[model samples]
Target: MKLYDHSVTVSSKRLNLFLKEIGVTDIERVEVNVREGGNLAQSYQDKSVNGKVPLLELDDGTYLSETVAISRYFDEITPNDLNLFGASTLERAKVEMWNRIVEIDGIQNAFQAFRNLSGIYADRENCVEAWGEEAKHRVELFLPKLDKQLGQSKYVATDNYTIADISAYIFVFVAVNALKVDVFETSQNIKRWFDDVSSRPALQN
Candidate 1:
């Protein structure tokens, strides 16, 4: 398998972290310079029309996109003690639930907030400042609920460090550092949860 990687993107970070945790090192990696519009090129888009990086090409030339879906593929293939998805039926459902929360509420808002506010992607798409500001505001709204959830549960989705926590950990950096929505200061549970999960060895890479 081969992975087309935009090394600095959040999606790449998530998949890299997951692959590290699962200890899958055999896949070939081809770096795509997104800032230079490598991913936007027609040559690259032919493989995956979405034009997203961390695109995986399977052995038979099957193309796969989306960070979490690629991570799930690796998780299923890799048999290790580190089952990041979960261990059972209810657990998988819980993971999917919280992962979606992190993806949509946390990560997607951060993407909109950063891209629109910063106008980083203005060359490719329309950057609306009003939407960016609203997205930035929406970033903190997800935190209180996450904090409440963490207050009751040991982890974000479930007890184990599942994919939801991985998504949330990535979101925290965008929320606290990049977007400057530091409501984690007031929400003790999520702050504690972020600090705890952020300390994992795989994240260090």
Candidate 2:
């Protein structure tokens, strides 16, 4: 399997974390930098084209896009019984719920914040200051929710860990690193939980 990715991107983090968690090691990693104008990078986004980083090209010539889809594909390839998704139906639903929230509140919010605030995508056509400001406001709103949740539980959803943690973890990293969010001040419990998860061998690398 060949995994296409780029450094510091949330999609890249998702693929890498899932691959490491699943013990997938036979991967041929390909890096694509879509920072500005990379042909192969644009191809991946336009599915009809041959480009997209974080795309998984299977040995059978199948091209897989989307980070979560790619991660679930890997899990199905290895073992359908893994607990990363969930052990029970209810647990799975809860995991999915948190995953959705993380994708929306964390990933979406962080992306807007980074692109607008960091000048990373400042020169892009659709980039606007208003969207970035709104995103940062939303990010501030999300921290309290996470802090409250973490204050009550060890993990995001159920009693055990799941892909919810993985999704939320990577996005939080982006929020702190790229968006310059001061994670510790706004949410101590969330900060503690993030610190614990960030130290995991799979993430620290």
> For candidate 1, lDDT tens digit of each residue in 21-72?
8888788899998877888888889998588788999999899989998998
Model 1 misplaced regions, further than 4 Å = none
Best by TM-score: 1
TM, every model: 0.96, 0.89
lDDT of 1 at 203: 73
In candidate 1, what residue range of length 10 has the lowest lDDT sum?
A: 176-185
- The Cα error of candidate 2 at residue 179, in Å, is 1.5
For model 1, the local distance difference test gives 0.87
In model 1, how large is the Cα lDDT of residue 46?
A: 96
Report the Cα lDDT for residue 89, model 2: 94
Q: Deviation in angstroms for 144 in model 2?
A: 0.9
